[model samples]
Target: MKPAIALPLLGLAPLLGASDLLVKALGIALVALPLLSLFGLLLPVLRRALSGHALWFGALLLAGVLVGLAQLLMQAFAFELHRALGPFLALLALPCLLLVAIEPAGPGAGLRQGLLFAACALLLGALRELLGHASLLAHGEWLGLGALHWQAAADGLPLFASAPGGLILLGLLLALVRLKP
Candidate 1:
């Protein structure tokens, strides 16, 4: 797959998983930034040390390790969220590996890509929550906050809360981005 499509396609699952709740999205962004930042910094150096299949294996291993560490940290401090995220947290590694493969050049490029992904996660998460539940951060309690939420409507488009809704919203957003001036 092309580099651009590869990362998002691989990442779509985790993005959908996290976008179910705004708090979950925050959890993902918090984890993704550091994971990608560290991964970005370390992978370039590791690439210099390996080649061929070894490089791919090493990159996968590295991404897995980084994701595992984030999972452990989440489990410890955010047990509820960790459980809610479930396998989706592990699926995060796929995008990381793809990110590493596509931008093996330098940390900055990888980090920029990571930031873009994290931003998307946050944007999608917030939009989904607002549209689906008519509230933002409505379940901060899930993240242990329990006190911060904003409700603006009695009901919202429930479809936005589901997987299909996420895909539809994503397509619309992609279409918007592709629009010419």
Candidate 2:
């Protein structure tokens, strides 16, 4: 994402917490990203149609409406996941707005972000669930992926189950990814 978006994504957080929620994290990334990009695509047009003051107000209204629509969709398609996602879904609007603030050079931009996030989400979710919960895809049933999960007979590291531990695990993962070849 452009700096416009990255700044907000980093700040709104709980995106990191999504790792703890597994299925809910996947649901948001799969469902919300496209809607965000679609709304984002229209930002330039809306910005052009309205002046400075109206632009801010219009964007806010649009963001709210979009968020509502996203929530409704979540409620409809992923009711359980939506409930699990809780208010964190509201924070998604920040990324949507930031993504739209800067024009994309091509259609692939959103796809790139979505795919990368999805992959990271998968890795983080799996890692957290494995070490933190001693299970892989523990809530897979919540997303109709029951076959994908299996609980272990042994216990896991309880620390990874918490938010701060997710951050630590994430930092460790980042370091691993950034290691020089």
Candidate 3:
């Protein structure tokens, strides 16, 4: 399954405890809806005879890096929604990177895959923000991360809280390193 389709479901874990029954149902729908939409968007492309799995993998890894960076920004800005949803979404990047690193094939395909993944990430991020805001308004707090709205916890560590992104970046770098002749 596409990261777009999978990340939001994974992201729901953080939000589960904080949400009420109705809010939880809404949240689940909100997350699942976007994945469904992304699936619709991607299905046509997937139906095509595209065989460059490696490039697609690299694209996904790149998209993960971008998603991580966005989450880092959210953390920096103390966006509670991001703190809740960011890491889980970030996790999707790994399998894609591994896929690319192990069996990447073409050159341009990675770029295409990256663009597709980026589109999905952007869509999911926006949805999360909107749904989170709504959930907070209705329930008096965001879904998962609670009312503790503070800047990212600081111990001056690299990739401190956003470790998933950091790991994905490391994976991407390693892939590149291995790809080098």
lDDT of each: 0.81, 0.70, 0.39
lDDT per residue for candidate 1 within 34-95, as digits (tens), equals 88888888887887999889988998899899999999999888989888778888877876
Better of 1 and 2 by TM-score: 1
> Against the correct fold, how does model 2 do in TM-score?
0.80
Q: Give candidate 3 regions above 4 Å deviation.
A: 1-29, 52-78, 92-140, 143-181
Worst 10 residues of 2 by lDDT: 5-14
Rank candidates, lDDT, best first.
1, 2, 3
Residue pairs with clashing backbones, model 1: none
Ranking by TM-score: 1, 2, 3
Model 3 scores worst on lDDT over the 10 consecutive residues at 152-161
- What lDDT would candidate 1 get against the real structure? 0.81
lDDT over C-alpha atoms for residue 175 of model 3:
63
Q: Pick the candidate with the highest lDDT.
A: 1
Poorest lDDT segment (10 consecutive residues) of candidate 1: 1-10
